[model samples]
Target: MAARSVLVAGGGIAGTAAALGLHKAGYDVTVVEAHPDTAEDIGAFLTLASNGMRALAELDATDAVTAVGFPLTVLRLLDDRGTEMAHGPLGAADDPALRYRCLLRGELNAALQAEAVRRGILLRHGARLTSVTDAPDGVTAHFADGTTLTAALLVGADGLNSTVRRTAVAPRTQPRYAGQHVYYGYTDGHTHAATDGPPTPPDTRAITMVRGSGAAFGYAVSPAGRTYWFARVAGDPLPVGGPGHRTARALLPLLRKDPTPAAGIVEACAGPVMVTNATEMPLGTPWHTGRVLLIGDAAHAASPATGQGASMALEDAVVLAKALRDSPDPHTAFARYEHHRRPRVEHNITVSGALSRGTRTTPADRGDDDTLTAQLAWDTPLPAAPGEHA
Candidate 1:
């Protein structure tokens, strides 16, 4: 039989990862990205927990990713006064290989995209998917540029506001605001020890969490002497507002009130602060219809607080490819994919939601759930990709 051709939409992490996996599974794959430049370094750095790194290894992209990122293992929690509240090791603590990682979002995307291209996958930029028509044997994707491609399967790896998801898979599925707004600003020439007094810890890989009144700040110093910091505040989700600098200015007062290094970091960052509301998709949304399927944020977007968004997306791509390679049809493959993923995704939603709420409210106000949070962070097992070694 001739190799099956698959069309993957949105060339971000999930899309590129899916292309690689499908090609490895003996299927022809082409990726269409609406954005003209996939190389642009946009957005703040993100955390790729142990599970996500393992998934990248399955695609043979771990070496490339690790080359450009830092390995993180310890997370320190502190109060607004910079006093240590509690400190713990990330992951199982015993398994050193499962160390947490922090990397620039753009670098990770670039690495994944480069890996896809290196494997001879065709990637088309500036092609926005307008609609998708499904047939019993195949699916036809119509691009906004008056171009169309027919393939045996259509995979929506687009992010939260996915066009493929809105047009074909589940029109009614929407991203709901999680009642928190976030800001991330990167500083150049500014050290993490911006605050006066004792110098910050020598360890650069620790993720420091500082809790203020109804708000939280997190900063991780990169090996390059740059500090990646973020602030989460309770706010309205709609009518997105301001450039990064302006947003940073607006949130400065709150940070000034905070007695941690956050105030200094925010004050030192250059222009362009990323401001957006935290959001997540409702669980139980259908992930596929006919020959079309949704992966990543299209199917389930988790709050960034969970730190599992990227990991979940990477997992989705690998598992979906496995199901397609093993099952006889698209429906069965998508069903199997969802069956194996929904429980964990939903569980993360709850875990992340509670954590996010805790940031906006007091920990005591949020109730005692440290045990649940710890289990979700360290004990929950991510499913292994097809062909991944145990």
Candidate 2:
């Protein structure tokens, strides 16, 4: 097959990274993102495990991300009564192969976009792909603005509620509500320790999960100096309001009643807060069609319970780009991509969920009982297996 031009939809972390990865492979690439510009601030901080950083490193943005973020020393786990359960060092701490980093989602996205554009890739912000049609020769994208563009392959990096996935994947199932509703936000805090005073981001965290008929609280110091936090109530009683602005005043009391004291710290957070309705689509087979393919949440929407949503997405980008570069036929590349990604992603979600089921009702371990264990403790490194072509 002749070398093909590629179109990537979405400007978020995965989309921007895909644009850069494909461009490095010498494909004429264009990225269409819904965000007006890449400069917008992402209020929330995300933990980029050592594995996700490895994938980003391939796109040459790992250092850029680290510039804005930092490594985590420890992941401290606790029971609801706030007693330590498990504490392990990250990176060389667990396995010599293990590594973990944290970052602001927006900053990472910005870095990838800059690198993508630096490499001569076209990145169009405020562009939303409405639909796509593919043939043996190329793929054509129809935009919401009624504009059309052609490319050799179209990548659906749009996201969990991805329109690209909906149209291409067919009768796409509606995302299921995770049993818990989450309240989350970020603020500056050098001390990851529960105690006050000057603090350093810890190799270990003061984290807990109290078994209760009620909500669960989670706290951690992200790569950035901010203390990132979240809480989950049994049903969907989320505090109404947006972040960095006005939040439902009623939310504090509800969160205050949380079993873990971490919930109180989150409650004390007087800055910005968002009561989010977290949802997920179970793993699906056949991650692609012909010239159009899926990456990240657009392909495998993992339950955040696994804390591998970003990791899985990053891995998808790495594997997909590698497969495309090697396979002469786009179809073959798509199949191979699915084979490599689908099973692993499905397993990650399943195992994380099993741990979460224990969290919902409270467990033998206070932190393990209702807290999101999978999200905090373990990290999976990026799969750097040489592509069949490489």
Q: Give the top-scoring candidate (lDDT).
A: 1
Minimum summed lDDT over a 10-residue window in model 1 is located at 360-369
Instruction: Count backbone overlaps in model 1.
Output: 1
Off by over 4 Å in 1: 1-3, 92-97, 191-196, 238-247, 359-390
The global C-alpha lDDT for each of the candidates, from Candidate 1 onward, is: 0.75, 0.62
List the RMSD of every prediction in angstroms: 5.6, 6.6
Per-residue alpha-carbon lDDT of candidate 2 for residues 1-390, written as tens digits (9 for 90 to 100): 336788888888788777777775667888998779875447655666656666666656665666665566566665544556767664333532235655667777887787777778888988878888877788888988999888878898888778777777544556665565556676464343333223334433333233323455556654344567665555643344432334535555654443344644554566766565555667563457777887887766655554677766776676667666766468777777676667667766565555454443322221111112222221322233346345
TM-score (C-alpha) between model 1 and the true structure: 0.87
Model 2 weakest lDDT span, ten residues long: 362-371
Tens-place lDDT digits, model 1, residues 1-390: 133889999898889989987887778999999888765446677888777766666666777787777777788887877678877776634544446778888888888888888999999899988999988878999988799999988899888898888889788878888878888877766545535446565467688888876467887777877778888887676474542334477778887775677787788887778877888888787888998898888888877776788887877777677777776477667776777778777777777766776643332111113432322231233343454332
Report residue 155 deviation for candidate 1 (angstroms): 0.6
